[model samples]
Target chain A: MSREAADGRAGTTVGPGPGTGTGQGTGTRGRTAVAPARARHLRTRLGLIVLGSLLVAVVGTVVLVDQLFGRAQRASLVDLLERDLQRVQALVAAGTLGADFVEQGAGGVRLQFVSNAGVVLLAPDATDPIPLAPTPVRSVTGERAELVGSAAWLLPSGLEIGTIRMALDVTEADADRATLRLSLLFAGGLLALVAGALAWVLVSGALRPLADLARQAVAVDPARPRLARYRGPEDEVAELARALNVALEAIAERQQAERDALAEVAHELAAPLTVVAGELRQLASAHPDDPRVRAAREAADELLHTSQDLLTLARGELDRAPDLSVVDLAAVARGVVDAYPGVTFATDGADGRVFAQPDRLRQVARNLVRNAVQAAGAERVRVAVEGGAEVRLRVEDDGPGMTPEALARVFDRYVSGRAGGVGVGLTVARRIVASFDGRIEARSEPGRGTVFEVTLPGWSSQVEGESAEA
Target chain B: MLVVEDDARLRGLVREALEATGHRVTAVGTGGDALLRAVDGGIDLVLLDLNLPDVDGIEVARRLHADGEVPIVMLTARGDVASRVEGLYAGAADYVTKPFELQELLARVHVRLRERGAGEGAIERAGLRLQTDVRTLWAGDAQVTLPEREAELLRLLLTHPGRVFSREDLEARLYGDDLPDSNTVEVFVYQLRRRIRALGVADPIRTVRGKGYTVL
Candidate 1:
């Protein structure tokens, strides 16, 4: 939409211009935008949870069983001590109470007796005046630790004679309990390891679909935005995929609607703009010396550009695939250059046939040539189309170039170098080119003219049914 | 060639493009008409659009391919991957999505016409006659059985004698997505040379460096 506004649709008055605008990431591989790192963390969190629960369970069972076994062993030891004291009492009642019972340490129980006269007698293995203490206390520890019991020795006449004390060694039982606790702890640790490994495998299996879904989601082209229905069981993962697919459908529908509206606007505006521009060109040429006529034409041209850019911005978030075709690059460039008499066009190679969508190709050519003409004096603007293994379209402008800083960000949207420049024109061109399997770049130096080079594979690059493009 | 489409405007465009390329095109606006002309004969390839008024394009494709006499190329508005695969399975030799470029469509039609006999006879070119039914080429008193790939390549270069095909173009047509080593094109050319030489005929294939391969 420059120079009499004639290039908007050129000769076509009511064309729809299929690839009007959608300067978004138009290529097929738009990442799913489902934060990959966050989805990966889910696997780790699930695995840790499973491992933690098994550990808690294994350790609890071991400690509880150890406590119960220890208590039972101590209770049996105390009962054995009491039984030995009863035997001593029977001897005393038979009137055969001799030192032999105490000296023999009968029944393998240590015995001690006091005649109620301060006389202390001890078993052979017992120390003198065995310290009075409760039996089977948990803190008890010695080479000969015992469960000790004591009772009063009475005669048949019902008179208390002496006190008898009996003790049984608990060293063997304590050793057995120690061994049991050691084994229980070892088994508990082993069980926990095994269970943890099992949990890891189970979690990985259950969440396999999540990883698959993540990959599939990333591969999904946001333009079409469809995900395959999960064929597995209808579990949480399936539900999540369904939810994402639903959101994708909504996004696709909204995009389709916006594109439809903008396309309608483009179609509606293109016809009138073409007719108006066509008439203004005639009027300006007829009255070449009339400043008023020239001014009116420029204003109309600027208005067309503004409206077109506005329509493009409105459809900025949507991406539509273009209609594929074998285009003549030289022909398209020649048409754009013809609009400006000052710009020179040149061709190289025999044929300039390249596979692309024609409407988009025209739009990009117009943007590049227009930008070049505006930068340099129209006389210094040169456009060339080279045909080969790859088709090349180069537009060069010998204007006061840009700073290295400006050159680096030239393609960035909103980077304007001059007044009345819609900075996004170049960015839009790049997206359109990329959507058709082409590349575009700009090279410039401080004092040198800027060269915009676009490389698209020649149509001859494809032979027959061998093209892998979808 | 037969152009079958429900949309009148699109049908007109396809017919005009094919005719401009000098193919005898019979343009129709429904599946029923496409079937009648196809069975009646003289049609080499059918350009069938999937959305038709009378019947499903796939069903029409099956009936057309039932006798295995004619090959079909589908023009579908469904650009999704599954539909393309489904169309191929239904016996279409190839497909071009809707909103397609006219030039690309012409190129595809050109290739399909060469691969299958565009008319009902042996193709005669470069002092060699290729019998598609027997998959063999007769050169003077000698005959050599052409492998499938060689036959496809030979037919393409033979049909478009003046057109130049770059190595990249040859590779794409021969291998689709399965690109082999870098020397694949050279190897295939060498093999074609031997086959022609063994038949006691001068090689017709010539290489245009930095451009492509062409047959004179």
Candidate 2:
């Protein structure tokens, strides 16, 4: 049966039901869901940084432009008012200055004349005379007329005419300056908006290759051990990919070396073991009735068993998935029970077929049954199978159970509770079950019996249907 | 027989064990040497070790298989299923893991040789002798001429004495793809036992409850 069918059957069997909730629900646990990746994560970060810098630059330029324009406009307006005063003085020296002349000569410029003797010499049409405290020529020569709200100047007639004052309105220039400020503010805001968007687009475009590289890295399968070469240009992103590829290559090589070492060790161990076992058997045959020889043979068998268990435990550390197939769990349990003849094992259930590697599952069954037999001492060990969407195989033994502390670490490697126990059997069993996406749990109390329940995905009609569809 | 094993002590033990069983043995330490010895011919069986110091044992087995129908049995320290499958697919007739029972190994060797038609011409066990050449059974002073199928069945049982053979196993062996009725094996066993009893010999064929039969 297909794995999916087995999983579906298991899911249905473990579904909620009365009396099924023992406070430890397998349904709510052990399912790992991978969250989806946010596609624009890198782009958002890069865009934010680019937009922030563009805004600062746009605002700074606008403020600097406004200040420079205001200063230059003020200085030029003052210079124009000073030039108007000179034209009015020239007209008076020609003896052609009058009310009519003053009004026509000032063309859109507000002009006024006042005498140093407090007498008004000329004024614009229907306009009052300008109020001025005429400064001495000595003080006036060093200081240029300043434009304070409006431009003003003081002048002296040739040794006989009283000093005349000239003034001009700067309202039109001020209005022009205000219009320039408003336009700059509006243009600067608009430019900032466009520039911020442009920066976001440009930054996202530039980071696309990096994002692609990240995706490739995520897609790499460490188990397959292939180089993760970046196909982009030789930039920083490519450099990062190259470095990661080198690390991966190193890891693969190290793993290969470790596998070779393990194989070598296994062979080295097996060769001597074979020789010892063969010689012992031969000796036992020569003197079949000798207790010492029999004991020696048993010791050799124990050594072989321990060695094999150690090898299995080491293999479990490698964490490779087992080759799965449809297996009969009842048959496996029966075989294991049969191996231990004196143990009373009662198996009652339907043919519990599951998707598992038969040999590995057999190992798990053997380990569990052996432990149960050992724990029960001279008592009976009962093995039962409950067939449903999932097959639950239970091994119970009525003997001195473990303490709370010991029970907690029963599956831990090298933590033996009994004398001569290898302590790796349960660890290996747990690893095997987990490889098939199954679970093994234990319950025990001091002076009470211990129970080990192994739950595996069972093969059923629904699984068959799914497999057929596939 | 040719034995290819790198360990000198193991090679010596295997040679001694097989020679003690009355079979001549040619022992080699390397795959190259094994190949050379095998190519010399007159070898009925090969006991090959997978972890040879020189060329791989699998390659040697393949080359030997290419040469002839000589059966090859792998004896190695590698007990994993993958290696066992690889060895079998590479033309090995049987696989025996390291630290195995000497008796089991010998039994496998005997079976392989028998399958190759190089078995003992006559097997004698428990005061009964069945001669393959003459197709006759001798019980002390009495003798009987048996049918060909009965003689073949007795030979198979006597060779692997005390080993149980289920009815299905016997059926597969005797009939191959052309299976008769399910009780055909039972009738044959019944007739063989009655005929042997009439010859003044105690019946050696034992019926295992729920299983099939065995001769101890």
Candidate 3:
């Protein structure tokens, strides 16, 4: 509407200019008109209902007063005029038709008495130059004749006399009508303001609890949110809060149950695993000369070690994650390489370090190395680190890389290529990485080798010096 | 030798293993038999189970030690450190957990016998010889190295001086707790008799009758 107004205004002045009216002024006004119109449209539905009702009440009051006062004032004036007519009739009957007598008999009214010949018989205080006309008389219809509310009478001698004309003064009544209109308008406006203030108080009071609940929900941490039930009402808003609280509690309980089960199972398995490993190690030592026995014993030992790794992973998932220390990635890599020499392990980026639990990182390296060795020939594994704000550790093998489907599912629990395992190694590794807010990704093509990239944040100031100790 | 175990299968297996190594082997399923033989006065060695049906193995071991200087090697379920420590503290000479290799048990048995031999003497046999008070032994003067358990057996034989000691007599000397069944002491003696022969000497410890033994 503003745009249209501006365009209409400009069209008259500019005589069809190229861009002056159409672009800048019209665009600004066009946008400006939208906000207030939207505001007004909203207001009319609510604001106007209250304002219009108040206005109707005020106007109705004025109209009612006018009808009542106007009628009452007119009746009073007619009564006074009737009295004047009666007094003039008596005076005429008595033959006191003198002007001085008429002046003394009429009270404050400008009265005139005329004969049937249309000549004024008596006049009192008639200052105006225009002569007063007798009230119109009809010989046949003689009930009452009034010209502007005057009465005329026919005397006994057939001379029509006692024609009285009086006027009502309404200066005070006019002033009172004006005062009534002003007061009604003032009272209506005051009522509207009070209604607006009342509406504001009611709306805000109604929404205060909801606003508090909304603030709490916004501040709720997604990872560890604890929503409490609203116990105040069985009403709709309270019911919504109650339902949300129930859902949050269910989620928290399930997560806690999973953690507890994982911890309990891991603890149960550890003792048995330790015993089995000890037995196997002893058997191998006893029959050092028997290669077949040694091989069997070594296989059993590996299975035991794998079980330990699974336990470690389960424990880490249950918030038993160890406090981290800064560890030299190069040193840990070299240690794993030395321990398992059959695998030709090489490390790059010896200068790089990372802040992590040393034992856990060792487990991660061992798990990745074990997986790589299983897929590729153990001799072709390589570990590389790239330094930055985050340290990236890459373990790659020349083994057949996985299909995209396998890569996607690799981190899922109980997924493995290794024969006769719980198949939890990769899953555990991923969980450990996630605990540190790090990420592990596997890239592979069918014929090419697989590469696992793990990136973790570098050391904070406290962990900086710990790399040397590790 | 005396075998003390609650399980019948394990008792039979232990008796067979020890008997195959060539001693009169006696096996009992309770600590009561061990206590009986311990009072009878001539058992040579006790292979006691730390987990017993009749008495607490450690308590039985302590009682047997109170009765006499009987060498006891405790056999238990393996790697149960608490029980093993308890057994040792209760006067058992050695503690070994179960599923143990027979060879490890035999090695412990031999060490206990040598320690006993160095402690006492005056025992002689076709495979073992003892000189009492000097606490030394000569198996044909080649100086056989016997572990404490075997030496203790020869020493007991020498103390009786060729009186043809019965399995019960040897059991009483070795296990001071309740005796194993009469055959348990026979098994350790057979093993002792064979290893002594391997050292080229007459076995010093002899089996007599239900009456007992004396060195002639």
Candidate 4:
């Protein structure tokens, strides 16, 4: 069931999630990731920067071209108007120029001779004089606007004759500039769009190697140590791959050392225990009637039991977070209490459901029941499960309860106040409960007996199917 | 009995205990020596520790299994389920976690050796249990002490209950390369018949006509 839930969480899609460009394995394996997600923000940020730069380049080019076109148009119009005016001024001073010169145009330069007082001297129907200006104005001969340049008609002398004005039709130049700007705008937009799309594609592919690294990391078994495979270029992703492999190795070596240390402790513990057990049995056989030898044998057995519990505590396998599951605490308690003869089990208010490691929970239940029956000399004990926001387990024993001083150190390691009690059981139980993020407490009176209660954070039974989806 | 363990203390204790039980024990402290001894071919049962210094204990068990029909009992302190399962999977007949009572290990060894039914000093089958050291036979609740020749003849028949041992073949094993006379095997077989009747187990040994005898 846990494997199914993990598979469900780390769905078919691996690698970084789309659009997010995060190397968090999509919704994949992120929930159980050992190391932090790599390449999470770089891809999206780089793509955005590339696309933004392309867009800015496109817009800047359009505005610059528009300004240059405007400058070129003015220069060309001024050159055309001035050259035609020179012709008209020379002809008029030579006393051979006529208004019919406008009909003989050069490059659509319509020559109009206007008086220095700013009137159209050749227009017989004209009544209003135009303002004196060397700029484009109203056109003639099938056009609306023209480049009109006006000057005073002067001969060989520097005397100003009637002001001569020349006009050039600019309708075609304006139309051509419009066409160029329109195409530039269209092509620039297309280039920006393609560049942005290409950047997004390239960056999304950049994190593929990271996804492969994540997959390899997921498959690593701590029982066996190995390095992750990497054959990519020496870039940022390669750096990340190297870091990840080093991290895996460091963790593997630490765990291996811990296991070796634990095994060493077991061997060290087993040697003396083995000697005691062997010697105790040898003595018991020689003096079958001696009660001291029998007591020594019992002590040897308790020593073995304590050694086992010590090893369990030292290994700390149950302390790791990934082992937790949705456990039925009531069910675990029932399985434990069924073995002890005088214990009565009941579900008082609710079926206790908690999210914890099932193996550790079973150990906790066993320790409590053993402590009550054996340590307190309780012939009959009542085990109950009550549930609210927290699922609480209560074990009540009708034995000679402890005094306040004894109760103060009950959970301490090797602090047994009663005979036939191996003092490590309560300590192991307390550590196991604490690992589940729970609380354990006891209440007792000298004659009234004792009540030991454990409270674990409850998992709502209604959300059973939700975890399967996750 | 063959005891193979790496730890000096454990190896010593196991060797001393098995020898104290009236069994000849050959003990070694390494897998290399164990495989060599298994090849020597007098071992009945092997108490192999899984945590060896040179070769993996599982690999040793596999090699020993390939060597012959000797049963291997895993004796180690690694109590995790995976190790237990792996040990059993590697052709081990039984596994006893360490910090164990020496008596329990002895009891388990006794059972394995009995099932193999080739241990020289102790043999039990068909309601007849022979303690070779004492040369005594017990059938149901009754006991009968046997003479040397009768004990040797009874042990051979009880080792293989259904198979018939001829008179000549019995003489060869009982006298051990000494040429005993022809009626020498018959005199012991005749003495073994009276002891079977005294033990009160019916069909203890059958005398096939023209053949020798067998325990049924």
Candidate 5:
């Protein structure tokens, strides 16, 4: 259901329901939809950015070119007008007057010339002076002259031959400007399309790494512990990947540790439970009067304890220390040693005392000693301690030592050198030690002896306040 | 009768409980030692804790199963579905997740024993075959007919062929919950011996020194 929801949210086209189509609704198809939809959305955003940038660039270039061309064409039209006016003035100065020149013009300039003495010289029509009412009337006196609008300028002849007036309208210039405007618009539109295409390529390239990282994030599984290759500077995405990898590593380590712990816990609990069931059955049936019933019951209790330890471990609950007091290490070791007469045991410590729950400490100490005895198969075991702000206790045995692997996980829950131990002992011991902010270490090699060391900070000092006698 | 456990108090309690249940038991702490003892000692069944100090409980179960079809009941502290399934797959006949009720364990023990009994023939030494489940006996093809007391005595002897049954064993099987006296079993055994000898077997039941009687 969650997978279906994820697929739906990604906006991939839904096909026929499961097992409904010959090929469309297969596993591969269903899986393919999600990523493609996600990719499509990402691509859409990239396309938009590329297209927008292209539009702005193309439009800006077209506007700039149109303004420059318009100004240049305007300037050239004015120059042509000035040169045509000079030619007309020269023709008048040469005294070359013809009826044809007044009737029809040689050039495409409409003209009417008049004398300053109130005499009309020439006109396309014999209208009187055509009154320079709308156009400017200037005396062509200087060699160089300027006109404000369409104006007639008088040359400096003093003949009073008057000015030849002509006006030119730029109808062809307007048509050419219109054509240039259309071409510029068309080119700008085309350029925008091309730019958009180019931008799509560049932007997608920039986001390619991010897209790949997303794919990796989707695929990575903590249980499998596949590390992803991260690239880029100290960017947010890179940091995210690094953080994810760290979290993944932790999860992988924890999962592995749990699996190993479970295996050991199973081993530890099975033996006695088997024995208890076996013995109980036999006693109930064939040996109701047998005195050995008592011993069988005791074994049953141990199985129960082992089960409890496993339960605690599974729940991640730490066991509580019961007998709170100052415990003399030597005395506790002596008692355990004396209890197991078949196994010789000794203690060598700086007479350090530890403030702790006595029973819990004893449990820790006993488990260590017992583990050593079981490994060594020796009749003798030794306990040693060192004093200071931190107190260290060591249990050594002349037993077959441990392999490196065993030593590494010796403190793990349900680990046992011998076959029948409920593996929870060492696990419980480690938990107890940790509760007191202490450390436990083991040193061993195969076929030699093994030593267990435990160190607790200020243990001896704390012990002085909580005396054993009290 | 070996008790394998690491907890001192729990071991003591278990021993007490089994004693109360009226069986002899020896307690050990680990799986390796338990296996050794199981091999050497004639233990009828093993109440195994899956979490042992040395060997994994499933491995122990496999070994114990391979050694013989000894009934193994796993005690798991973890009550997860996977663990129980795994235990069964690994050869545990039954699983009891802790902390189990004492009565439940006793009941399981009874069930395992009873199931074991159903698998084997009731009559041990004699060619007579008996079915404990249906309570029927056959000598050859036909059903064997015998006096009630004689049939009862034969039934007990058949279940344990090599086992030597004292006079007290007969009283426990024949008598109700209470015992009249130790001598009562002697009389019954003697009469049972006579009835068998009279059938021309010439005393299939043998008397041992100190111990009472044997089918061998």
Candidate 6:
């Protein structure tokens, strides 16, 4: 079976552009936006918690105050009724229970005397008399009723006096409690609203520095890297900003050092190879028919090619941006195929335009074809370009394919199937393709042919127009 | 032409190659020397290396460009795209990375000189002659008048012979910065080859697979 058919195209797939997954925190803006949103969410949650606890406390306090005040007021009302009863008893004993007594008892209290045979003796005031039961003790009864306290006494003439019940009006106390309830509810609700507003304002104001730090962090560009110095107070937010700035500084320094070292190494390696190649070319020209000279020239060329590959590998995916220009992939493939006349390389595509550096794209195409040719052995290598939303270049070789283990790590550095292969070609190719917002993948099966596919974002006229406007 | 390179051996080879191609060459080891020699009024072109001992080569190219319109070609070991773009922005006419074929470098120099209209001559290869001044192609005893672009393409192909020119290279040469389309070069090559074949001579232009058209 074909590699693609057997494997169902299971290969390493890399997406276009920089960040692929959501919430990966890849870009500076992504990270900055996430930080503020999370902080605000946390602050709002904490504020609601505080407001909830405050409301609970207020409700508890109102209930407790209402209970204590109700008990004290009721007790005082009972005492007043007791004092009135004593006065009434004295009047009865002095035989002065007449119109004057009635007039004095009309102050929010009603007095009534009942006989033991269920007949009323004397009823003071125009209010209803209190219900009396024959009992030899003082008692408070009729909660929220006009008659609140009652008592029974025995006369000095050895005649059994009926119970003397004094009724006290509770309308004023009831009205006061209703007013207290309304005022407490109104005050508690207003306090809750004010507390919530206050918390919102304070929390947002406190988090202003964090928002500022986020904005600053977003504005930090790697191309022109500037430290995110926080000028605010030395609080947690400021400290966080300072720490980020320190980390950025350290990272920038390390990257700068790495770039410098790579450039130095590339220059050092390229210089000697250039000198050697130039000398070899001169020698070859001087002795045009010398086989030894021709061999030396070939060796020099191979050495130069390998050194260039090494430089590309060492440079990796950093140090430079691809020189974006409109390039025809078919043309680049043709150029690479021209170098290998012995191989049966076929290219089929129309005009596949992409934005890329010409030289780098040429290097990538050349490397892939070279690898394919070597892998195909004596068979043919086919390079086909399909252009649509994305331009896909597929290089298929008809030879013994790789094992699953080899296919898994085919693009890795220093991992090669062929003897004496430096193994940096595919690694460099992948890096170059990725730099162009493209990717490279390989699919193969043991004893079958291998196919390496490179996909790049296609160039559009609309994008060209937009860029030209910019 | 004035060549600026820090390395002695590469400079010697470059000097020999240019002299072999029948061009007067002046070699300098420093950017300062290059600047001094560039303004001496007899220099037709400047071949500058990016790395110099005394002053930076990009600075020299900028100064030379500021002085006049003498086309500058940067010769450097730095093959990165950024360096190439930087050299161009610094006013270099072309860029050639190190370990490049001597024939390619010579071809680029000849093209630059031809674009400047410094020398008018006929380039001959494989019994085909391209006269730059009169814009004519002579295939053995048969001759044909050519269009301006066709003559320019023929001249470039004859100058380089077997060197491959990508579409971008050809477009840049033909239209300067105003690119027309991707297939423009292919069409021009096809028309030129047809016109030469109509002159009762065999077509000398061969398409280098995947690279470009070349006359071998």
**What are the models' TM-scores?**
0.57, 0.55, 0.39, 0.53, 0.38, 0.66
Question: How does candidate 1 score on lDDT?
Answer: 0.67
Candidate 2: Cα lDDT at B7: 92
lDDT for B134 in candidate 6 is: 91
What is the C-alpha local distance difference test score of candidate 4?
Answer: 0.69
In candidate 1, which residue ranges exceed 4 Å CA deviation?
Answer: A1-34, A95-108, A114-119, A125-129, A133-144, A153-162, A250-339, A342-367, A371-437, A442-452, A456-470, B1-216
* Candidate 1, DockQ score (0 to 1): 0.05
Candidate 2: residue B208 lDDT (0-100): 48
Chain B, candidate 6: TM-score: 0.63
Candidate number that wins on DockQ, 4 or 5: 4
Worst 10 residues of 5 chain A by lDDT: A14-23
Query: lDDT (0-100) at residue A92 of candidate 3?
Result: 60
Q: Which stretches of candidate 6 lie over 4 Å from their true place?
A: A1-8, A11-41, A79-147, A151-162, A167-234, A278-326, A340-344, A353-355, A370-381, A387-390, A397-452, A455-470, B16-23, B77-90, B97-111, B118-216
True contacts kept of 1: 0.00
Per-residue error at A86 for model 3, in Å?
Answer: 11
Expressed as tens digits, the lDDT of each residue in A253-287 for candidate 2 is 88667656765676678768767878887898899
Q: Per-residue CA lDDT of candidate 3, range A287-341, in tens?
A: 7898987777667656655755555443332222222334666677667666566
lDDT of 6: 0.71
Instruction: Give lDDT tens digits, candidate 6, residues A222-280.
Output: 53346776666778888898898897898778766775686677677666777777778
Residues B24-69, model 6: lDDT tens digits? 9999899888888876878888899999988988888878887976
List, for all models, the DockQ compared with the true complex.
0.05, 0.13, 0.01, 0.11, 0.03, 0.14
> Which candidate's TM-score is highest?
6
Alpha carbon deviation, residue A273, candidate 3 (Å): 2.4
lDDT of 5 by residue, B140-207 (tens): 56554465666666665554443444454455446534558667666666665554544444445555
Q: Please, what are the lDDT tens digits per residue for candidate 5 over residues A22-60?
A: 122223445555764676577667777777777777677
Which numbered prediction scores highest in lDDT against the true structure? 6
Q: What is the lDDT of every predicted structure here?
A: 0.67, 0.67, 0.58, 0.69, 0.58, 0.71
Chain A TM-scores, one per candidate? 0.64, 0.61, 0.48, 0.54, 0.43, 0.66
Chain B TM-score for candidate 4: 0.55
* Interface RMSD of each candidate, angstroms, one decimal: 10.7, 12.6, 24.6, 21.1, 23.4, 10.2
